[model samples]
Target: MSHQPLIDGFEFATAGARQKGRWPVRELPRLRDMLASDAGEIAYELEGTRDERGRPGLRLSLQGTLELRCQRCLEPMPFEVGADEVLVLAASQAEIDAEPADAHAPDRVLAGKEMPVRDLIEDQLILELPYAPRHEGCAAGAGQRADERISPFAGLRGLMRGKH
Candidate 1:
């Protein structure tokens, strides 16, 4: 939807709501820090459901391409991103904090009547990005060059031997 929608997590799950939308990359402020260029769009689908644990949750799926800087070559690179996550709903921040950390459990979040769909979508996409982006070929070349470089201390060996 073009207009931003406020989601009521509890009601959404009860009604089994589902929606799909797209957002321009430039629209997400947090993602801007990671992107080399804001020139793409992210497609996302969100569905409400109750997990096996009987907790109300949202299932989010996202696909997009991001322009990112290559760490090795410092050039622009295209990164394909896809993510899917289930966020369990909690009545308040305290409720989420009270739950013990479980690696096998889905993440918990405070559900609100006016949850911003755009912010949720952006959060998922940001998590999908690589911490360090690089071009495969460039990375290999950089590694080889590093191995071939001579150490500046090479001359010190001759002086130590009284050959200088």
Candidate 2:
């Protein structure tokens, strides 16, 4: 949560560094709005490593359960989050900007003197979240009590039965 920079991103990658920890989900201010309740901790591991093609990159792994609001039923539900990503380091923003767009290309982040750990984790989590969260077999009427349910056809059902 502190604004302090964790490490020089380029140096970390070059040195093959490793860092891991369990942080409270509430500490991530940027990710707060996405959660129904920020009541748990997220485990994260960030390592400097090389990709399959021998490209220097950072490997990030996150594991946690998030409390999210089900869009269908508007109820709170637990969603398990597990993500692993390799982010290729570009020498500079200009170099990254000149590259052609390709879906197969690994994600690129400009190497910098200062890279905040919290921001990196938050960015990945934001990208991984579903645009619309939902619980299985849940709908608009999902959590409603039977006594609170209303039917316009209630009166018509008795009328039709009498007519028959």
Candidate 3:
């Protein structure tokens, strides 16, 4: 917890400013629901830019480790998060809607006189999270218990083979 950074979107972009900071994981209330434990920190860097098309934008970079619950085993797993995102600032919601729809399009944010750096970072962080967070290799997963596993279809298999 610290002084929340706020900047004028247009002013920052026009001035080509840069800001960086670290936030404790627990402080991001929006992302708390998806986390296994609130015991880590995330570092972020935000830089203002003007695109070739004369559009004001912000580039955000985030790095940190998040503790997520493995969906299968419900065990805590460490997930490394490193993401870079570009957000094009639009004057209004209509301006954003006027743009052609494309899955590969950069995100657009409504330009505001006061934009919170913490909110911007958390928005991107939520998007970076997996739809179903799980460990690639969970110690409590099927692989480690395969020997003791028995299928419900085992009896059917024996009948098919005519074996008691």
Which candidate has the top score in lDDT? 3
lDDT preference between candidates 1 and 3, better one: 3
What lDDT tens digits, residue by residue, belong to model 3 across residues 49-134? Answer: 87767789988899999998887789888889999877878887777767676555667787889888878888778767766665
Evaluated against the true structure, the overall lDDT of model 2 is: 0.73
Please list the residue runs of candidate 2 whose C-alpha ends up more than 4 Å from where it truly belongs after superposition.
1-5, 139-164
State the weakest 10-residue window (summed lDDT) of model 1.
155-164
The list of candidate 1 runs beyond 4 A from truth reads 1-4, 139-141, 144-164
TM-score of model 2 (CA atoms): 0.79
lDDT of 1 by residue, 63-110 (tens): 888898887778889988788888778886667656665556676666
Model 3 bad stretches (over 4 Å) = 1-4, 143-164
Better of 2 and 3 by TM-score: 3
Candidate 2 at residue 123, lDDT? 74
Q: State each model's C-alpha RMSD to the native.
A: 14.8, 16.1, 14.4
Tell me the tens digit of each residue's lDDT in model 2 across 104-135.
66777766778778877887776667666776
Instruction: Name the Cα RMSD for model 1.
Output: 14.8
